[model samples]
Target chain A: MLENIISELEKQFQLEAVDHNSSDLVFLTIDRDHAVMAIDLLKWKFGYKHFVLLTAVDFLEEGKFQLTYILNNPDTKTDIGVRVRIDREDANMVSAHHLWPTVATYQRELKEMFGIDFPGSPRLNDPFILEGWEGTPPYRRDFDTKAFAASFYHQREGRTTNDPATYMKEKLYPNE
Target chain B: MSKKEFFPMDGDRTKYPEIKSDGTADIDLSSHKYIKLWHGPNHPGITGNMAVELTLCGDEVVEGITHVGYLHRGFEKLMERRKYIQNFPLVCRIAVPEPDYNEYNYATCIENLTGIDVPEKGMWLRTLTLEMARLQGFLMWIGGMAGAIGFGTVGQWANYCRDLVLDRFEELTGGRIYHIYILPGGVRNDIPEGFKDRMEKNLREIEGFMKDIRRAFFDNYVFKKRSVGVGYIDPAWVFDYGIVGPNARAAGFKHDIRKNYPYAKYAELDFEITTAKDSDIYTRAFLRFEELLKDIDLIRQILDKMPEKGDHISKVSNMMNLKIPAGETYVRSECTRGEYGYYLVADGSEYPRRVNVRGPSYTHGVALLEKMLVNVNIADVAQLMVSLHTYPPEIER
Candidate 1:
C-alpha cells in the first residue's frame, strides 16, 4: 500500500522513500514545499486519515532541521510517516491548514515555540508564548537553555558564599 | 434524504459551522432564550473544564455552543523546555483520569529514539500495568456513561469496583492517580512480593463485577432505549476522524495498535481485540465493557508468562546530563484512552527540541464530536459526551 502511495506521489510531488529498519513504520521524505500537498494526497487517495502529530528536530552542526507529520489510518491499520527538511537560516513551510484543519493549529503552535514560519496559517500573530519578547525561539537548538531559565525564572538574587567556609563555620569549628 | 429538508437536526446546527474552520461562529454568551442551561465548566454531565450552553425550546434544544480551553496547562509546549526524564512527569497531567497512557507513550518514544531495549521481564511488567490501566479506565467510562444515562445505581457499583483497581495501582506504583512509574529505560519497580497473587485476586473480583454490569446497566431497559439507536456514527468515517481504541473497534475497525504494532510484551499475550458491529452509543459502551473483560484475561496471561525473577528497571547511567542523538521518532502505544503517541525530536542536547503529543482525545473531541453531535438531541448531548469519554485537557495540552 505504501509503495503505491510512493509511486503516485512521485508524479505530483518530490518525494524520497527512505529505507529504514523501523518495521511497521513507513517513513516517506518530502521537500518542505510539497509537505502539505503530499499529506493531502496521502489522506485523499489512501486511507491515512488520522493526523498523528507534528514535530521538528534540530541539527545544529548540519545547519538544517527536519519536520515530520505522523499519520495513522485505523481502517488499513497502517502508519504513514511524512518528513520534510528546512534550512536553519530560513525555516518555513506551507501551512497544512488548508487540507487538514487541525494541522493549522499545530502549525501555529510550532511557529510560536520553535520560531519556524508557516506563511499561510492564521493565528500566527496570536501571542501564544513569550509575549512581547525579542530573542531567538526558545525551542531552537541555538537557544541556550541555562540562560533562558535563569533569566525568566526565580533564582538566588546576588549573594555568593563558599560551601566549605559555611560548613566549617556552622558545623566543625564553632569557636572560630 | 431530501436536500431541502436538510435532515432536521436536534438543535440549531446552523449556529455552529458545519465545517469547524477558524470563525464561522463564536460562543454566544448572551441573548434571551427561554431555558438557559450551563452544562458544566464544573457541573455534572461535562468532563473537565468545558461547558456547553444549551438554549432549550422546551424539552427540545433550540441552540448549543461549546466552551473549552479552561484547563489548558500547556503540557505539550512545556515538554520542549524539559529533558526526556522530566517530561515523563509532565505528560501524565495531559489526561488525569488515564495517565499511564501518556507515561507509557513517552517512555516508548525515548526507548525508540535512544535505541534502548527493555529487558524481557521489564517488558512483561509494562504490559501488565498497561492492561490494568485499561481495565480501570474502562470501568470509569462505564460509570460515567451509566450516570449520564440516569442509571445512578450502576454508576455507583462501577465506581466501587474501580476503587478496588485504584487500590491495586496505588500499592503497585506508590501513587494512586498519577503513577510516574514507567520511565524511558524501564518501569520504576518490580512486582511486589505478592503483587501477582493480589492482581490475580483483583481480576477474579472484577470478573464478578463485570457480571453485575451485564445485569444492572447493559440489560437495563432505559440504557438500551436511550443508547442503542441514539448517536449513530458511520463505520466508514473511522479513518476520516482518526478514531482509536474501543471507539474505533466498536465501529467495526479492526485496528489494534497492540496487535498491528506490538511495542511491549503485547506480542506475547494471547487475547482477541474486542470489537462491536453496531455503531451507536450502546455498542460503543458495550465494546468498552467487553474490552474490560479482555484486559482481565490479558493481565492474567502477563502474570503467568512473566519471568520469575529479573530486573524490573533498566539502570540509567546519567539522569541530569546526557547528550541525545540528533534524530526524530514518533512512538505510538495502545493507551487506555486510545492511540497515544509521542513525537519526540532530539537535537543532541539534554532537552528535546520539539515534543508534540498526538492524543486521541484531541481529534475525538473537536472533529469527531462535532460530527456526532449532529442529529443527536440536546437532551442526549451529555450522554453522548460521556459515552465518547473524552479528556479535554489532553486535547488542549
Candidate 2:
C-alpha cells in the first residue's frame, strides 16, 4: 500500500532518498526548495493530512541543519517524515504556516531556539519561550549552555552540585 | 460547520471591533472600544501557567494572544548534554498530569532506535501505568473543568478520586506524581502482591464517586447552561490545527492514538473511542467523563489478563551504558490531552544528538486557545481552555 503511494510521489516529485524506520513510517529526504511542495502534495494529493510536528537538528560538522516535517495519514495509519537540509551559514526556509496554523508556533520556536528563520511566517521574531534572549540561539550545536549559564546566572556560595556517576567513580573507582 | 450553529454568540455590534483587510481584528485602543485584560500567568484557572492577553469589548473577547514562558526550563536543551540514562526521570517532568506518556514515548523511541524488545509482562505493565495515568489525569481535569464553572464541590470530589489513584501509583511505582517507571527496555518494577484486589476496591470507590460526579456535575443545570454550546471546535480544524485526543474526538473525529496506532498492548485491550459531535465545552467534558469510566474498565481488563509471574522489566544491566545508533524517529502516544510525542535523533554517541519534545500543549494551549478565544465571553475563557485540556509545562517543553 505504501509502495504504491511512494511510487506515485516519485513519479511526480524529485526523490532524493527513501528510508523506512518501520513498516508504516517512511522517511523522505528531499531538496530544501521542493520540500514544502512535496508536503503540499502529500496533504492535498495523498491522505497525509495530519501535521504531527516540525523540528530541526543541527548537524554541526556538516554545516547544515536537517529540518523534519512529520505528517500522518489517519486513514492508512501511516506517517511520512519529510526531511529537508538547509545551510547553517544562512539558515532560513520557506514558511509553512499556510499548511497548518500550528506550524507558525513551531517556526516561532525554531527562530528563537535554532536561529533558523522562516520567511513570511507571522510573529517570526517573537520569543516563544526564552524572554529577552540576545545571545546565539541556544539550540544551535555551537552554543555552550554551561558557559552561558555560568556567566549569565549567579550561584550562591556552597551551592555546588556534583554529577552522581562521576562522583561515584571519583570516590569508589578512582584508580581504574 | 459554522460555529454559530452550536451557539449564537451575543454581543453589542457597535462595541465590537472590525476585521482589517489582513484578517486580523482591527483592535485600535485609541478608539476606546476595546479594553485589554490579562487572564493569567498566575493560576489562569488551570493547573499549569499561561496567560491569555485578551482584547475585550464589554464582556466579549475581541482577540486573545496567549503569552507563555512562565514555566520554561529548557528541557530539550538539557537533554542534549545529558547521557541517555540521566534523562529517564527528566522526561516525566515534561507533562505534570500524565508523565507516564512522556516516559513511555521516550523509552519507546530509544528502544526503537536501539532495537530493544520489552518483555510481554513489561508491556502489559506499561499499558497499565499509561491507563492509570489517563485515569488520574482525567480525574484532575474533571476538578479543573467543574471548578471553572463555579462547581467547587465537584472539584474537591474529583481531586479526592485522583488521590486514591495516586495511592495505587505510590505503591506500584513509588511515586505519586512523576513515575519514572517506563524505562527504555521495560518498566521499573513488578506489580506488588494483592495489587489487583486493592485496585479493584479503589475502582469501586472511584466508580461510586463517578456516579456522584455525573449527577452533581454533568446533570447540574448551571454547568450545562454555562458550557453546553460554548467553546465549539469546528471539525475542519482538527487536521489543520493539529487537534487530537478528546478535543478532536469531541468534534466527531474517531481518531484516538490507541485505536489508530494501537501501541503498548492497547491492541489487546477492549475499549471504545469516546466521541461527541457537539464539540463544545459541555460535550467535551461529558465525553471525558465517559472516557474516565472506560479507563476503569480497561484497567480491570489489563489486571485480568496480566501474567501471574514473569519478567516485568527487560535486561538492561546499566542505564548509563546505553547508547543509540545514528538515526531519527518520532514516537507518539495518546496522552490525556492529545498525541504526545518525542522526536529523537542519535549520532551514534553516548549523549543524545537532539531530543525534541512534541508535547500536546505545544499546539492546543498556544494556537488553539488563541483561535478559540475570539468573540467568547470573558467568563468562558477558563472553561474553554480547560475543555481543550492543555498543560503549560508541556507547552514550555
Please tell me which predicted candidate would have the highest DockQ against the true structure: 2
Per-model CA lDDT versus the true structure: 0.75, 0.89
Using all chains and alpha carbons, the TM-scores for the candidates as numbered come to: 0.80, 0.95
Interface RMSD over true interface Cα atoms for each candidate: 4.1, 0.9
lDDT of 1 by residue, B1-397 (tens): 4532332343455643333464533334354434667777786777667776665544545445455667866575577767778887888888787888788888887777777678878888888778878888888888888878678888888888888889889988998889998887788988888888887788788788889989988998888878876776678776556678778888887778898887788887787777787767889888888888888888888888999988888777886675578766677788766788877767778987777788787767765776576445667888878877788887667
The 10-residue segment with the lowest total lDDT in model 1 chain B: B1-10
lDDT of 2 by residue, A120-155 (tens): 998889877888999799889899888998998997
Encode model 2's per-residue lDDT on B193-256: one tens digit a residue. 9999999999999999999999998999988888988988999999888999899999999989
Clashes of 2: 0
Write down the C-alpha DockQ for each prediction: 0.23, 0.62
